[model samples]
Target chain A: MVEYKDGADFLSPDPIETQVLQGSQDSEGVELMVKKNNDRLTGWVSYTLSRSMVLINGLYEEQKVNGGVPYPSNFDRPHSFNLVANYRISRRLSFSSNIVYSTGRPVTLPVAAYYAEGRPFLLYSARNAYRIPDYFRIDLSVNLEGNLKFKKVAHSFWMLNVYNLTGRSNAYSVFYEVEDGAINGYQLSVFARPIITLSWNFKFGNYNSN
Target chain B: MNIQHTYKYTVTKLFPGGVRPKMHLWVVLIIALAVNSCIEPYFADIGDEPELISIEGSIIKGLSRQEIVISRTTSLGNPVFEPVKGCLVSVMDELNNEFVFDETYNGIYTLEIDQSSLVEGRNYKMVVVTPGGAHYESEYEILESSVPVDSVYYDIEPSLDPVNGIEADGLQFYVDLLAPDTVSRYFRWKITETYEYTSAGPIHYYYMDLSFEPVVPDDIWGLYRCWKTDELEDIFLTSTLNLATNEKKQIPLNYVSTLNDRLKIRYSLLVHQYALDEEAYNYFMQNKIATEGSGGLYTRQPQQPITNIYNVDDASERVLGYFWTSEMTSRRIFVSKLPELDVKDYFYPLEIFNMEDHGAGPFPMAIMEEDGVRITGSPICFDCTRRGGTTERPDFWE
Candidate 1:
């Protein structure tokens, strides 16, 4: 169930309404980061541990307990981590990249059934029935900038590889409805794309100001 | 002063005849930028914390009790609020009398009371304590609503000189109630239809002034029977009215008809007590599943029964109906006709029909004045493909 301060205004967020900003929950997961300072290099190795859940008490009051139920939606990931690095190629160019790996999200699997109008209502039998494969990916980007003939105009070209090493990563697992009683699960994968952008900018306003 | 110095060393090699010059531009670009650029490292991860919670719900006015709802903010569309497991809740009146409510469902608590307990002038408030010792409170006023009733009218018109010699008619009932103040309330109504047909054949047609969604007859033949033939107990529509007053302003009476005939209509209303706030209104709207739940949840309009008017007769079709006289009075007036049409003079090339796909018989019925006309003001065969045998009858009162 969703709450709004004025009425279901989807545009605004209610302070009382908490939301998932980004990334899934995981416990003690590792991440790799690398950066270049001038001719020097810097990097980091980190870890995370957490979980979250969501419920629709407004619609199905039966599932609410205590004040509400701790359904499977709350446990995204208990822990996670990242790794990064950077390298200087020349005065006009530099290379930077990061690698991330985390455990998959939890999915509810329906098992038992309750009778409704002679049809069995599929009940979510277990809290977290299945998990997708682990997630790991690398991203690399190069930055280049120079002054052109046009006054105040600077040209820049960037090449970004969202997934540098690993081709694809799966975030969550999904299962299709059985037409004749065959249990099957569908795997979801992380999006990977290589982006090339070339841009030129003219600065009329002050580049730096109070 | 910390002074930085720059230095360069060059090595020259002589060839057989002339010296060759080599420039290392790549090395110069990278070394130049490395002298000024720097990177910062910062990363921190935090876990989830229990979010805040808020409560809302309704209590029937008579005993001043309704289901109470407590919800919380979560990232998922289906956010979880605490379940009603073992929480304790009470309604406090002005005299400090506390009435305990039961946790009927997960986050719902219900209180049962009689008419005398929920006096209109009394003030009330609900207080709840969570099992973990968190406290929540909300206040409410015992607001009363008057059953509202609007004008009622009918649609009667004559079919162009061909089909049935009698006029076709339809009925429309309308009502608009206002609750300028308060949060929520429940509404219910019971309507009855009385009509007489000219033929004894199976009831082939039925029409009602339904909102957007038309409620068709379960037993097609039942369309011809009168409210008197069947038990009165079986002739009503029941629904919950937990919407805001601004939302319940208009309610329309949809009709069900079998054939071209005259009809008499009557209905009664029952209003439950409760109030709604902006929070409750938003929750209902955002989470509202159907189009019917969105805009004004009620529908009321002028109903034209007879397909035509100029070729029809003037009949008293005395249709008697009343709204909740307990709270407000309702009145209705029957009209002879709505807008009429002259189909003979309209221009058209010819109508096409597909007998197999639509299961329809002929195009002649498409010319009926009630059937909708194309942009060219000409009628298209109701079943263009006709595979399913469906016929378009704009002339038939929908």
Candidate 2:
């Protein structure tokens, strides 16, 4: 039995006055996993399909929000899949990689405009009415081990990582502005390029065995 | 399910196969850099915003004619309005005296009220019946006594925005109110500006009507002088509710930069002052913050204003506005010259024309002059009325 809940709802585009509204939250999900382990290679592929929804309306006044109706929460990403693989080429060198993809977060937007008494105003939809762009990225890493000597006191390895190998410009936010008598939107993203990092790690007990 | 065995390793119980992520997977997670997108700005593509009704109006104590504007919102980024017509609107007093409003124009309703019936201390409310038969009403508001304006004037000062570190000299207008009564004294100002402008001179050349070529004299062409009035939209509010003495002095009203033509010549600024209670004062301040912000809530989160108006049948229906009642007192001031400020010169493109330039058969022609520069071109350069101005001077003009 699903139970109702209580939260704040802001539907009008001014002051952002939070009104007490009643609603319910529900979520359902499915997961799939594939793991391959052997002497030469070890990798895992995990996929998930999930739905997160929130329904909020004032029972007395019928205030439509949290979203006017059922809506996705800020962190509701319906489809997420992650792939990881590590291939041992030689006793000293190995290659590891990953591919990650998921839906973006929900964002609120003003879809219309009006002017009263010569002062311009905007009209907004339900809270978190739309979403940003989906996110996709791939990464690659290489591990090189030092010469193996069991009698030695310590051992070391060099790890090289290349992030966002595809250079996909994932959108963090979408903002609107009126220019030249038209509404123009621009997407803001924190990282749109590839990044590489290298680190030399060591262990005292020669525990770097893969 | 072997619960007892898996319970020993509680962390692995979350997954179906109890597959724990290995250490190599954690080492591959490295991300985030300075993002760069080569895409240009695009018109936002999204669903439509719901159409809502907007209403605004007020009734003054001594004013005879009161008007209300009812309109609907348009598409995104397009502020052009669509009038909501065929609605019944009226105001009812506590004494049961109902003053009806008729749609004189598109979405504009007006009423001619008997000034005597607008008695102070009477409670008044507005009732609107939409075309869909939905009824709405505003909470009753008592007509408070208007506080008299002691003085209205302007001073030359530098525009200082300390936050942005900006400084520039401009004209700043202010108002002073008389001492408040024992009750709270809250005030808001509506500034109406009327200015007098002139044509280049008289009728330069009359080639239109072939009769009585140049019948009117240069100074008496009825086009030499005209007046235009405009109601500014900036909301200004002040109150003495939380003060020790409850006095208002030099309350800043409106600021005018020297770049515009508002103070170029003879100008009048009429301050329509409304005395409201603390509740209504707070409501108007909310709108003031919203109306003055960038994009008016478009860039920010949505917030519902706590208004006094509500639906009669359904509490869910939201009508966007406040139907206010107050005793309004107004004061007018004239500004003819600002010798201390350098105003930008007006640019008028005037060209020379003659009857021989088109058809040679016109009888007489008159040349118009401005600062001894004589030229004849379009009627706009010769008649102030060609622009949106009236030849009849306002009766209140000094």
How does each model score on TM-score?
A: 0.31, 0.69
Q: lDDT per residue, candidate 2, B243-351, as tens digits?
A: 7775778999888765555567788889988888776786677667566655433433464444577789988776676677788888999988688876544455566
Least accurate 10 contiguous residues by lDDT in model 2 chain B: B24-33
Q: How many angstroms is residue B314 displaced in model 2 relative to the true structure, after the best TM-score fit?
A: 2.6
Query: Per-residue lDDT tens digits of candidate 1, residues B165-238?
Result: 54433343444445444423433333333322211222222222222122334543432222221112211122
Count residue pairs with overlapping backbones in model 1: 102
Candidate number achieving the greatest DockQ relative to the actual structure = 2
Candidate 2 accuracy as TM-score: 0.69
List the candidate 2 regions with Cα displacement exceeding 4 Å.
A1-83, A87-97, A101-103, A125-130, A138-169, A189-210, B1-48, B159-170, B204-221, B294-302, B350-366, B369-374, B377-380
Candidate 2 collision pairs? A12-B303, A14-B303, A16-B303, A192-B35, B204-B366
Report the error of model 2 at residue A100, Å. 2.9
